[model samples]
Target: MKIAILGAGYGGMAAAFDLLRAGQDVTVFESAEAAGGLAAGFKAPGWDWSVERFYHHWFQSDAHMLKLMDDLGLRHKMLFPRPKTVMYHRGKFYPFDSIPAALLYPGLGWGVNKIRFGLVGLYLRLTNNWQPLEQTTVEAWMRKWAGDSVYREMWEPMLVGKFGERYAQQVNMAWMWARLHARTTRLGTYQGGFQAFSDDFAAHLRGLGGKILFSTPVTALQSEADGSWTVRSAAGDQRFDRVLSTTSPGWMARLAPQLPEDYLKGLLELKHLGAVVMVLALRRQLSPQGYYWYNLPKSAGFPYLALVEHTNFVSPEHFGGDHILYMGDYLETDHAYFQMSQEELLERFLPSLARINPDFQPDWVRQSWLFRTPYAQPVPLLNHSRHIPAVRTPLAGLYFASMSQVYPWDRGTNFAVEIGRRAAEMILTDGQA
Candidate 1:
């Protein structure tokens, strides 16, 4: 069967790889000039390794991604680094990676508050069943399990920073539970970065007789009377026995208007949080204690969500001895910060960077890059699972697979690959039937 897979991200590419392995003809369509989607990377002239536009890292629990790397013979390039993650509250940064660190930190207070915080963390980490927690809000769960002190000092700020004002009573506890359970203290990344992995994946797919069309966005998707798919793009129209879309559901709705009205309503009901990240190539490190992630509390009065010193986790030597930092925020698309220019964003964040390191100077920044995406995060509300579209859509020859389908586990490269493979399996099974 000839298949058309839209979007050349990990998910789409994964589907193509599986289909090609089954002796099916596959073609991948990517709007961008390159692949990898959100995990895509860029490089400077003197840099030997590429850096992701937005900060990215893998947890030890990312089994799907690890297995794929091993299968692709790229597992040797994986590096597991134990980087220091801290929290900024009351004008100071405190290490907050482990239970001991949280207990020792003054932000959560002493005695019962500390014990409550530790117990809450333990509960979240040990939890494997998320169905019961789906209807509960993170705010309510945190307050009930950890008390108001812990919620205000630790979780609330982080939630507000990530979800803005909507996080107070809207975000689900299942999302939080999954996040806590799926992440480990040890973080992993490829030696050359994810873009290298993606490029290799695409090349391997091509070697398997699959075709990838870059810089070609699917403009329209039409269903034929005989149960085939017509995928229209700038490159031209092509007929495929099956078409799987790895783009966002919102995008799928636009591309294929023939979808059922109920399906489109479900797609529109799934909310997404966008992201704006400012990547800086600096002459010197910003964090004095070499912390990789710094979660800012509302008390800190910082504008952005978190400051991720990428070079702190990896090494500056890979980028010609320049320290790389990411000032990133997840916000609604209408947020003013989302509309700001690179120069304007840099101006606003530079002062905040100095607060982290008083010695930070304007000349310290060698170069800066800004990346913005409209669908960075899928906001999981109560009973979000009910809204997830089926891999097999109402259309006979068309299927939908996207980040939104990877529920309970937040959107990431690992789940993307999993969903993509599942979509391919569904297509193959249906074809056999």
Candidate 2:
């Protein structure tokens, strides 16, 4: 069987690898000149650094990703970086990575509030069943233990920032369980950077007799009455026994118009949050605190949302002793900040870093770049499970396996790879792949 996988991101790559292992002819089509989709990288001008187009990291529970690295013989390149996280609350920055920190953190109160809050976390981790809570709002779930004061002062800001106002109130409590499960321990990165994973994965795919076509975007996909699907790309059209799409749901909805009208409408109804990130290669480190920091600012004054001091987490020597900084923000595509030129965005983002470290002069920046992802994240509204797409589409021989299917589970490289493998297994079970 000839299987064509669209989008060479984590999900697409996983699908290709799984299909190849199943003794099927597999080919992957990537729109970008490189694989990795959102995680792809490019060379910076002055510093000569190679990094991901967007910031990415793997959590402790990312077993599938770890297994993939081992299978590809790239396991030795993986390194666990112990980076702490600080939350900016009410004109103050509080370290909040561990239970001890939370207990001592003043922003969340010290007496009954803190004790009750800690109990809530214990329940989330201990509770094997989370379905009953899935139907409940996150606001209600948190409010139950943390109380209204702690919810408003500590949790609401971050929730609102991640999922816009409309969806913030609707997020499932199970989502919090997944988040806590994944983020319990340390985070992993490659020896050089995440971009290294992309390079190695592409090479491994080629070595396994798999074909990958980069800079080739599939313009359309249609299934014939005879059950063969034709994938039309910039290069040409190719017929395949199966076509698995790991691209954005929005992209899939546009490309596979032959899918059921209800499915298409469901995909179209799902909204995504876009991101604008300014990555800087600097001469000196910015934050004195040893980790990533979320700057709330004076209530959304500037476009900058989070600051990642690359050197603080990973060694600067890995990038030839250069300090790297990332200032990230999320917005709708048409938002004013999203419309700003790279120069304008950088000009606005730099001052925030400068305030963090007085010594962070603009001249210290040897190179800089802007990465904008239009459909980087899905916004899960209240009771989002009903809207989740199935693994199979209405059209035969076509499958949908994007991040949207992993509702309540946040989007990440780990989830994408899991979804891909599961999608392939489903097809094989049905005697398709």
Candidate 3:
């Protein structure tokens, strides 16, 4: 069987590997010059390791990604480090990584509020069933379980920062539950970098007789009457026995117009929050207490949502003694931030960096890069599961897999790999049938 994958991200690459292993000819198409999608990294002249365009880290519980590493003989490169995570509130930053930190932290308040916050965390961690939780909004659920003060002081700012004003209120509790359950204090990263791993994975797939076309975007897709797929790109058009699209639902709809109108409507109805990240190579570290991640409350007056010092988590030694920091914000497509240049963004955020460190200055920045994506986060609304499209579409020989489909688990590379493999299995089963 011949298969065509619509993207070269972790999900598409995973599906390509699975099909190739099963003796199917596979070709993957990627719009970017390199692979890894959101996990893709950028390297500077003096840097020995590539840094992700957007900040990325894996949890200790990312079983699918861990297993993929083991299978690829790259498990030894995985490193888990306990990095300090802090929260900024009322003009001060405090440690918020562990339970003790939460209890001691001043922002969450004292007595019953703090106790309720801890109990809510435990409940989210312990609760396995997400079906009931899906019906409730995060705002409502948090107010009920942890009270208004905890919700307002701790969660509301973060939610508003991420989801924006339009959809923040509609965010479901299941999404929050998944986020709380899936994360761990100990964060994981590849020893060299994620890009290094992705490059190696692509090489291994090529060794298995799979072909990947970088910088080649699939412009259109059509379903032939004889149950085959015609994938068109600027390069040319090629028919495949099966086609699996790992692009976002919005992108898939545009690429494959032959899809049913109802399916296209479903795809269009799925809203996503985009991201803009400014990666800075600094002469000195920004966080005074060596915090890796700092969640900024809305009251901080910063333009960005969070401050992630990548070198604080990984070592500065990898990047020629320069500290790496990522200031990221999630916004709707029409947000004004997306239109701003890197220089403009820096101008807006540089003062916030100084606020974190009084001695900080623009001269400390050695180099900087800006990255933007239109589909960084899928907005999980009330009963989002019912709206999630099936892996197998209505058209035979055409399939879909995306981050939006990885519901009740939050979107991540681990679930991307899982959904990719699931799509491959469905195709293989159809072939058997």
Candidate 4:
């Protein structure tokens, strides 16, 4: 079978990997010059390592990501480190990585709030049944079970930071449940970077005779009377036995107008948030306390949702002794973060740095890079599972898989790989059928 995969992101690549291994002729089309999609990275001169454009890491619980690495023979490149993660409280950063740290968190209060929060967390962690939880919003559920103060202090800011004020209260409880159920304190990363692993995997796929057309965007896709699909690009139209699109639902609808009107409308109705990240190389370390991750809620007057000291997680040695830090947030397309120039954003975020370190100065920055993606986060509204598009679309020989489909579990490379392989399996089965 000849399979065409759109978007050389993790999902597209993973699908191609399985299809190629299954003896299918697979060709991947990526808009970017390299693979990795949103998770791609850039390298600078004098740097031994490349850093993710949008900062990323894996959890020990990410079985799909780990298995792919093991299959790629790059499992040894995985590094799980106990980097300190701090949550903000009354002008101080405190560790919240373990049970004790969570219990000791001053923001949750010393009495019933903590008890309720703990009990609620334990319930969500232990329960395998999450379908029922989708009926209620995280805001309402947490407020009812964990108490208003607990919800206000902990969950609200993070929710707002993720989905923004518009959809924050609309996000379902199952999304929150999947997050706690899937995450681990020991964060993992590739020894070099995610891009390095992706590049290596692409090379390996090419060795297996899989064709990856990086920098080639699919201009159009439509089914033909002969039962094959035409995938048009700058290179030329290519007919394939099947087509899988890993692009956002909006992009998919635009590329393939033959999809039903109702389906296209449904695709456009799915709301999502973009992500803006500012990566800085500093002459000195940003977090003086050796902290790697910091949660700064907007409710606490913080402009950004997170401040990640990447070098603290890896090492400055990999980046030529320059410290790496990332300040980022998920926002609506109209948000100022999406529109602002990097210089403007730097000035706006600089004061927050002073708050993090009173003696800090702008002169400490060596270089900075800003990255923005419009479809970074899918808003998990009430009863979100019902809206997720399947790997096999209503259109014959046309498939759709995106981060939006990885519901209950938020977007990550692990689930991306998981969904991609699922799509590949369906394609192979349908071909056989």
Note the Cα lDDT for every prediction shown: 0.89, 0.79, 0.90, 0.91
lDDT digits (tens) for residues 1-433 of candidate 2: 8889998998888878877888889989998988888877766544334677778888877888988877778888888877878777555567877788878788777788887888887877777776676787779988877799888877777777776666678777777766765565577788757666787788888888899999999999988888899999987989998889988888998898878899999989987888888888888777777766554642545456678886777777667778888888776787677778988888877776655766777898888888888887787766677888888887778898988787668888888988998988877776633
In order of lDDT, best first, we have 4, 3, 1, 2
Q: How close is candidate 4 to the true structure, as a TM-score?
A: 0.99
How high is each candidate's TM-score? 0.98, 0.95, 0.98, 0.99
What is the per-residue lDDT of model 4 for residues 50-138, given as tens digits with 9 covering 90 to 100? Answer: 99999999999999998898888889989998899999999899999999999999999988998999999899889999999999999
Backbone clash pairs in model 3 (N, Cα, C under 3 Å; residues 3+ apart or in different chains), count = 0
Model 1 regions more than 4 Å off: none
* Greater-lDDT candidate between 1 and 3: 3
Q: Number of clashing residue pairs in every model?
A: 0, 0, 0, 0
TM-score of candidate 2 to 2 decimals: 0.95
Error of 3 at 105 (Å): 1.3
- List, residue by residue over 47-123, the lDDT tens digit for candidate 1: 97889987888988899888888777888888999999998867888898887787899988899988888888888
TM-score preference between candidates 2 and 3, better one = 3
Ranking by TM-score: 4, 3, 1, 2
Off by over 4 Å in 3: none
